[model samples]
Target: MLRTRIITALILAPIVIGILIYAPKPLMGLFFLLCATACLLETLSFMLPAFENRLAGKHVDTIVTKASGETHTKIFAPETRRPMLITVGLAWCMFLLMIFGGAEGAFGSLVAGILATIMVGCFLADDVQLGAARSISMVFSLAYSVLPWVAVWQIYLMAPHSRYILLVVIIVWCGDTGGYFGGRMLGGKVFGDRKLAPKISPKKTWEGAVCGLLLSIVV
Candidate 1:
């Protein structure tokens, strides 16, 4: 899998870079939309694996694709894929509409919609803790997918000629890359659920974070 991933990256990275540099808007939109769609769908699948399962009811396992007696737990199963694709499509359509509507309208609507969706997800969760976790996941999902998207779009729109975009990117990029490798190599780690707060940031360690921070500075 790693080998395939590397080969695919090697093959496509230059073409993608070319598109980012030369094609700009069209490529960015296409890539962002694809990424957004895939990520959202994967998340929904992971979050709600029984999306198709419950609907199948008593005959759930008997509903096989072909000769098989059992339903395949494929990632891109027909039932799961359709909803995700549809949701992302509608979201992107709204995003495009917002683009024509003005920045305040666009960003405001985007963020609002995201927050509202997360809130809804939170409400649907089992309890307060689950709701909070779902909310956090949704928020992080939006930020991870949307922030870079907004930044890239804005960079193309606002600073087409400015060299400073690369400068800022390089600094952050170098820092992140350096921090990742440094932490893995240098940071002393304890295995299992060693708790610091045992309440907040429980999974985190004092060691790895410090190493990452120092590595970022050095880089």
Candidate 2:
């Protein structure tokens, strides 16, 4: 697993670096837009699996109640994936586009767009069992996994803050490396045999966390 992670990182590192260093503003914005879209989709898969299945065109079993107080079973067909992606993905893209266009009211327009999208999603949900979960996930996914990428893009556009953004990235990389190595070296041996949060992450250790914090500070 470790070897696979390293190999994957080696393959992706150059592509990420090249985009960060050489891509023009528009291309850079596009890169983050794609990243945010992928993250949003992945988050939805975990937070609202039913919604993901629906988007993938799977027929979902649902029950309906008629006015006569009788219930019937039904299989609801899925919607087109591409159209949904394009529709929802455009919200993030529009925000990036507005930043690139340097509009004075970009933030306001983005907020309005987000609100309108959320409202539409909530109103259109037909399955009561999954509707609230999916609707809440839609809003949370945008704020959690999507907006941070948009913030990074905004930071990159600022010539002065761009270097600081790179520094932050380097710091995070250093912390990750420190944590992995430190845990391997001192975790089970020197830091007592007990595991930190054994139910969650069996490999994490207090010593490793401290080492990561120190490395990040040094970076």
Candidate 3:
């Protein structure tokens, strides 16, 4: 797994650097937008596996309209993929709209509006199959994966010529590397023998976290 991660990083680093340093603002924003969409899909799938399934067919039986034109249903398979796609689509639409709607001065408001749109989408997608828990997870995961990228874009727009963006990226990568190596080397030692969140992530350790922090500071 570590080797795979390293390889992936090696392959992506140059492309990401090129984009961050040389690409135009619109291109950079678009690249991160695509990444955010992929992250949203992956996070939703992790929370609800059915979300990743291809849309085989839309079963009309899933919803039935009555004479009063009211749709009613008691139990039905979740329209996971469709609803998730729609929700994500709505979020991105709002994101783009905000980006073009006075980004020069209202960056924070634009981000808030985009995030609000995503939250609304999550609530609207809540249903029997896509329970509230899963819906909330989707919202959190989207925020987790997308917000940092948005911040990077914001920094770029705010400081187009500054190398601080590159510095931040380097620090993040250094921290990740330090944590991985530190955990492997020190996590099982009697002196520092413990996991950080054993129930959630058996491989994480306080030692690793400290190493990460130190490395980030040094970088």
Candidate 4:
């Protein structure tokens, strides 16, 4: 499934990017908005897993101790989007856009709105009971959803040849590839008994991460 997702992302990125470069600003905006909405929808649904709800007496709240030693039980109440952080983020971002929605307002406001949205999402989802959910919904959502949309917007500003955006996708793909094949092939046993992340992803080794870093530098 991971391989399939990676492949799908790789294949569809170029198609979406091609449309962004070829289409008008309004159309390009529509394309990115769809992507952003899908990402946000998926990110928000992580908290209320179907199987998780069936489990009785399972408290999914994460406890965090602040620098001042005050404990905070952060409950990710994903019952609905009415009062959760996801809706809070969506409303805030749209509010920002609405605030700057005017004939005289520069196009920069839209870009700023997206960035601020991602920033707010990351901040609101600081403490999480599930590591996978936290990374995909909060951390990865911020970067993946916001940055790609930002890049497409940037391409609208520099149309006709938005190959630089393709470069970004290529760099990530190559780095991921290197991490997978290189680690399994060359990496013998760097992290003997130490687990990187047993809960979220048990197979991701330190060597794999280092290999990705090196591949990124090359890219």
> Which of the two candidates, 1 or 3, achieves a greater lDDT against the reference?
3
Q: Would you list the clashing residue pairs of candidate 4?
A: none
Quote each prediction's TM-score: 0.52, 0.71, 0.66, 0.53
RMSD of each: 8.4, 8.9, 10.1, 10.3
lDDT assessment of candidate 1: 0.52
Comparison by lDDT, 3 against 4, better one: 3
Candidate 2 at 66: error in angstroms?
Answer: 41
lDDT of 4 by residue, 1-219 (tens): 568868997899778667645777566566666666665555445433321233322344434466445333344444323223554365336433533353234355545554555454445443443322332344444454554565455554553555665566677877887788766755647766454565656677667777887898898
lDDT of 1 by residue, 179-212 (tens): 4554455444543344334455444444455555
Query: How accurate locally is residue 139 in candidate 2, as Cα lDDT from 0 to 100?
Result: 68
Q: What is the lDDT of candidate 3?
A: 0.63
Q: What do the candidate models score in CA lDDT, each in turn? A: 0.52, 0.64, 0.63, 0.53
Instruction: Assess candidate 2 and give its TM-score to the true structure.
Output: 0.71
lDDT at 48 for candidate 1? 36
